[model samples]
Target: MVLAHAEHSGPRVLNIGEVLAQLSDDFPTMTASKIRFLEEKGLITPNRTPAGYRQYSENDVERLRFVLSLQRDQYLPLKVIKDYLDAIDRGERPENLPPGVKVSPRIVSDEFAAEMTGRVRALTEEQLRTESGASVPLLQSLLSFGLIQHSNGRFDEHALQVAKACVQLESHGLEPRHLRPFQAAAEREFGLVERAVSPLSSRRDAASQARAAEAAREISELCLTLHRALVQDRIARMDS
Candidate 1:
């Protein structure tokens, strides 16, 4: 049984995979990446083996469990959790962390936020059709082709933009049926992004989630830029 803030002087330590296996049964969302994130935030310092592997003591595990509990049960933001951990490290018994506190840490850069911001209001199907000049059949085609998405009973900004783009494409005789390859290519790109951020997304922390999101956006942007450049090169070759 793990005790809260349990201390141990023995040399027993667990590796990242072992730690995840041990904690996953309890904290189903726990991951090796999250453990690393906690270490990065100075919440729990594990020893390093001769081969540069992370070795966590029993106390470190307890501290990690404590911090994760605060996150899952209390919903305390990472900054608050770090402050509490700092207090504990100073040999101070900190008060109970408040529950359900909504704090947005500056986990994302301002430029990234600006680049990624979407329309705040969700549009219904009718509203989307009216705003994007897309007919019902076209909207349905977009939905069937997975070009638009609706989650929790709301169509998001991406769907709106896709509808508008499809409308414009129709004017140029590029039908929705011809756009399947674009969606498939996008999915492939997303697969690459997911693989790239596997280390960070493996963690379940707020900071990791935020960082992973930003990284995904940046990677996607890079992929789009590359695709555009390649298309431009093809156009130049055709002209030549």
Candidate 2:
């Protein structure tokens, strides 16, 4: 069975050193760079100190545990992992287990959810453009390259964030064409997710559809988290 856990409150936040000491045994390959990568990819948002150092809370550590466990045991790509996380963030807890994967139950107290309640806000494309200051052509370019997408003819909060980032990247001379690799990579990840969810999704029963959706959402978030960690490590090497 795949090991999974949930975040709970803690008395104090932990620094990188403490985080490393705590996680080193379970996730042998976990490095500071990967943690930073998760931060960068918005998977785990750690608070920054006055000195610009990261301070990860207990919540952050549990998130890392879930991420590492999924990558090591499930061999899921980052995209799927991310989708899973996103679903949770959106308050959708999916059936996590699929064929060949058995996830243990995650335990969390009522207090656990107190700090993390609310609806995930979604926005229209026009609203996204208005708020993000993204130009029409830039939005078009992102769509053309498959970087940012419209869901149900509207952009979700995640899509808005991606569009905003793409706008910033454009200022640095990385155009949407340069981001096509990311799109291709996402498609490949989607392919893997489809294979995993198709069997359940194809069943005629009504419950099967819900299960498939849940499975798809969870795996997708898991893959995204994994992707961020792997990419963070590679990017970190450049400074080393």
Candidate 3:
């Protein structure tokens, strides 16, 4: 299990040799010297035991994996990768990820980390309908109502999610036309989020842009929670 923090009370820490053993399969060329060089370059910082032995947390291992993947796959220079890591450490999502490289969270299972760098498949219209189990008329309704959209004859994961949810709601007598208010409400909520993050977003620096994106994500989640709570509170009144 990956521990978020490197406290001794948490998961067992790996010595340098153990860390190499864990990573060697994917990075056979990796060595103690290379790891040390990375540390000198400010790429990673493993903890030191009482006797001066290097100890690495699971998060450190994942960070190393990310750094190595960027170097090998994207051929990114250490400076660029360091900047990306700095943004991530600050809880901001960097914008310069290569096409298929996804940076999973530090506290991820080994299996999950192994599968982290894959591409998101863009579904065709037929594939979206098949995967979502959305009927032709329902799909048409979703398209007309602006509940879902496609680009270049392709739909992304978000489109599929909206289609599937619309299918489920259709059974409960909620048609696409009846869901227009949701799209409007989403637009209004986005306006609020956009306005709140505008100062950060308007800045030209990569760090500022990343901060703006993170802020928007956080604000959007809060808005969703408030919307859900308000709806639930009204529904509870019917039980009184």
Lowest-lDDT window of 10 residues in candidate 3? 1-10
Worst 10 residues of 1 by lDDT: 101-110
| Winning candidate number (TM-score) | 3
For model 2, residues 122-146, the per-residue Cα lDDT tens digits are 5777898999889989999888877
Q: lDDT of each model, Cα atoms only?
A: 0.70, 0.69, 0.78
What residue runs in model 3 are displaced by over 4 Å at the alpha carbon?
Answer: 1-15, 18-62, 65-120
Model 1 residue 44 CA deviation in Å: 33
Q: Best by lDDT, which number?
A: 3
Instruction: Please provide TM-scores, in order, for all candidate models, with all chains considered together.
Output: 0.50, 0.44, 0.60
In candidate 1, the residue pairs with backbone N, CA or C atoms under 3 Å apart (3 or more residues apart, or in different chains) clash, namely: none
Question: What is candidate 1's TM-score against the reference?
Answer: 0.50
Alpha-carbon RMSD to native, per candidate: 16.4, 13.2, 9.2
